[model samples]
Target: MSEPVVGLVVSHATLAEGLVQSVRQIAGAEADALRALSNEGCGPEALQKSVRDALGDGPGIVFTDMPSGSCAFAARRLTLDRDDTAVVCGVNLPMLLDFVFHRDLPLPELVDRLVSKGKSAITGSCREVAGHGDRAAAG
Candidate 1:
């Protein structure tokens, strides 16, 4: 009955900026939807308030870049008090695109889909080499 929410927390301005274009192309991820965790060259909570403020009274998801980073911790803390919010770490373009494309899906369902796609996108060194080798084999 309400619009979904999505936010991002990044380690650095440069890395965040780098993801902007790719996110735009895949998921229509917006600049306004992103929050920098290290503004003023300080710690994590700097962007938490801004992110919370941006999502005022809305039920949606938050995406953080690293699992062990402060951004993820802060996000976890924020959502701990709210039943309507979901925070996911290690977010990638495929996950975002899946979320955007399947916007009509239920919240829990969206989370599962995003996680599934995101995990599947991860490839180890051997897997990467094997994938290329398979391509070469086909050719």
Candidate 2:
């Protein structure tokens, strides 16, 4: 069997930590491959080092909270040095959940799947439900 790709969640404040904790909650032991890093009180170099340390030397997918920020900056740098690493920004719970279950896929395919899953998870319908004055979102 192929080696499962690791997942690195990098974000501001405690977002990264919270996401990983929640993933562990829902996925249990299977979500062990995913780790979290935060730029709460660190500079660029420190954040970069933390990201590298969390990612190690294995093939990994770095999920950043935003497309343009410190988290993305650190992860994007890794891709230039290693082909096995990928950066997928704007992460969500659904994306991480999908990733934990599909880590065995090839790096490129896994990244693509993550992006799709993340985008798909962002769905909502806020409209007037026939006769309701208050705005309601359909689930």
Candidate 3:
């Protein structure tokens, strides 16, 4: 069997830690497949080092809270030369949950799945609720 893919959550402040906690709460035994990194009071270089240290030489996915933020920047910088690493931005609970269930997929396929799932998970409240009547009524 293929080795299980590792997950790295990077975000500003305590967001990464909190997200990992939520993942652990929901994922149960599968939580060991993931780790979290916080950029709180840390410079870009420090953050990059931390992420690299967490990743080591293994295959993993880095989830960032924002596409244009430092966490994403660090993640991108660290994974640029590595084919075994992927960075997925705008991470939410749905995306992380998807990763927990599908981490065994190959790196490229897993990245694709995460990007798709993350984008699909963002929807207006009306759209999120099926049979919620007309948009005007919902508003």
For each of the candidates, give the backbone clash count: 0, 0, 0
Name model 1 segments beyond 4 Å from true: 27-40, 125-139
What's the CA RMSD for each of the models?
Answer: 3.8, 3.1, 4.1
Cα displacement (Å) at residue 67, model 2 = 0.3
lDDT of 2 by residue, 1-139 (tens): 8788999999999999999999999988364599988888888888888888889897899999999989999899878988889999999999999999999999988988989999877864436444554545354
Q: Tens-digit lDDT track for model 3 on 22-69?
A: 988987736568898888888989989999998667788989999987
lDDT of 1 by residue, 1-139 (tens): 5465554545445555456556776666555554333433645566667566655665667777778666667677778788878888887767766766665566788788889999987755566577665453431
The candidate, 1 or 2, that scores higher on lDDT is: 2
Worst 10 residues of 3 by lDDT: 130-139
Candidate with the larger lDDT of 1 and 3: 3
TM-score of each: 0.73, 0.89, 0.85
Model 2 alpha-carbon drift over 4 Å, by segment: 129-139
Per-residue lDDT value at 139 in model 3: 21
**Candidates sorted on TM-score, descending:** 2, 3, 1
Q: Report how far off residue 23 is in candidate 3 (Å).
A: 1.3
Question: Each prediction's Cα lDDT score?
Answer: 0.65, 0.88, 0.85
The total of clashing pairs for model 1 equals: 0
Candidate 3 runs further than 4 Å off? 126-139
